[model samples]
Target: MTKSTFHAAPLLTLCLVLWALPLGAQKKKDNLQKPMAGPRATALRVSWLYVSADLGAQKVGRVQIGREIVVAEKSSDWLRVFANTDIEEEHTSDAPIFDTNDTPPPISGWIQAKGIVIDNTPNGDQILMGAAADQEALASDPRGPVNAARTAHLLYRRLVEMFPNSPLAAEAAWRAADILWQLQKADSSSRPSAKEQAPYLRDQMDEDGLKKVIKFYPNTRQADFAAYELLDNKLCGDWQGQEKCPEKESEIYEKYAAEHPESPRTPQALYLAVYRQAVLTDMYTADNNDKKSDAAHNHARELAAKLRDKFPQSDYTARATMLVFKLDQRIPVYGIEKE
Candidate 1:
């Protein structure tokens, strides 16, 4: 071969190797997190993970109800599997996991196949949704499992991920996001900064999942629910005896009502606007600003009228009526009444 041909051959080999390096690295990275090759499954009850397929085998851990697993092999009534066993510690006080990447490695063990629901199981989406609803109810009970909320959240998430085309996917996604938002709200409320008047002064709940629900399920009732939850981030932590607090909050609620007239939350938003304007009327009265106070009173009455006209049978309309009565009677809706 010519000397130039030899040199060109080496150069071509080097170029090919350089091009393959990134692909090779990406493949390795993907392999590191690749789920076990098997049908995705979840437990129907609290099941024990054993070192072997026998009931007498050493117990390694547990598979909580609705926790995702991959069925790799089976022996009669027992199945060998890889399961996500990341059980968070029971928190005595409100606390939230800040790190999203804290997933523990999946544990490999054997569990009973009797209660295992696979992705292809008939009515699997409904089954998962029911299980998640059960867990959510348990989460609300004072004596229920500490991780019930988190488990329900995960189960709902798994339903959405595993059965994206199912009829229940949108609702499942909303429930998952709502659970996480509530959990974060509880933790944020427990902090000292929660007493601050401005929302910016306090820790905020993560909004990415809620935003995803709105993005992926537009025009759905679930999307409307997510949009209402987003308003919590814009609210004052505490009114702090300020007129501006109610003034600003009333505007926020009024805008929400106008923009989402068909939303289920519209009545509540209107009621909130009425309530805040009533409070502002009181605040302005206390400040001896009669002009602003009269304007606030008129606005409160107008919102109450809107509530009654728009949502005649709504409970919020009744509440708005009561607020209007108080405003007309000169009863203070906020702070102490003038002696």
Candidate 2:
């Protein structure tokens, strides 16, 4: 046969063989030739997690795809099994063919792109949704919370820097703080203090930090409470034993009352002031035996008069009035004897 004819004959025969074998059979043969990982079937490692949902109506066992999220605490969906490792692409084969360089095929592209939910609280959805822009920027790629938080931190920092005067800037600042705090909390190496955890709370602050908040957002509702916290912290500390305790407490009350006369906590501030004065004066009189003493007599009389006149409706008013009358009865031999 001619060279051209001989080649054409083989090509025709090849076409016939290709056409004759059905698609399904060819696919089956290909699958059969694929090498398998080992004798055991490829299966993921899974664990059962106890879950309470439906107000404890349904107790379920779940496999943890990732971490337990706070939001999941209330979810009705009982269980989730997740893939731990990549799946082997090799199938069962008769021939012992080994490819040392071949790697397992990764999971479905989309399932991984969803990443893992951390907090899973009511607010979690918002945080995740907010991250969509970021996820898209990373080329539909995926990573864990640690990397996600780092990305979020960068975004918030940029937002804060770019919009310094905007509320969004403040929010971003808080978010950045929260992300750092969360990362620290998630780390098992060390624990953080209440003060250290304050940043993660987002615009919320500890006592010292609240002072800064009050200063920065003076008219804000948060500042109103912050101011009270500052004053409460000061008053409840060492001031109680000092000679100027009553006076300092009184000054704080007056200032707070003046600044926020209509505030709900105004009564509380006033009560604290009056209480301090009454107690201190009582201590002074009880300590000094001499009724003729100027400091004791003057302070006791002054506080009693102040409470009766200024805070008649106060809870301490009735008690203070009786004290004033008692002080009146003790005014003998001071050149101003009681009638």
Candidate of highest TM-score: 1
lDDT of 1 at 37: 54
lDDT of each structure?
Answer: 0.80, 0.40
Q: How far in Å is the alpha carbon of 170 misplaced in model 2?
A: 12
Worst window of 10 by summed lDDT in candidate 1: 2-11
Return the lDDT, model 2, position 338.
Answer: 34
Q: Could you estimate the TM-score for every candidate? A: 0.82, 0.32
Candidate 1 segments exceeding 4 Å error: 1-36, 87-102
lDDT of 2 at 290: 49
Clashing pairs in 1: none
The alpha-carbon lDDT assigned to residue 113 of candidate 2 equals 16
Clashing pairs in 2: 35-91, 36-91, 71-120, 71-121
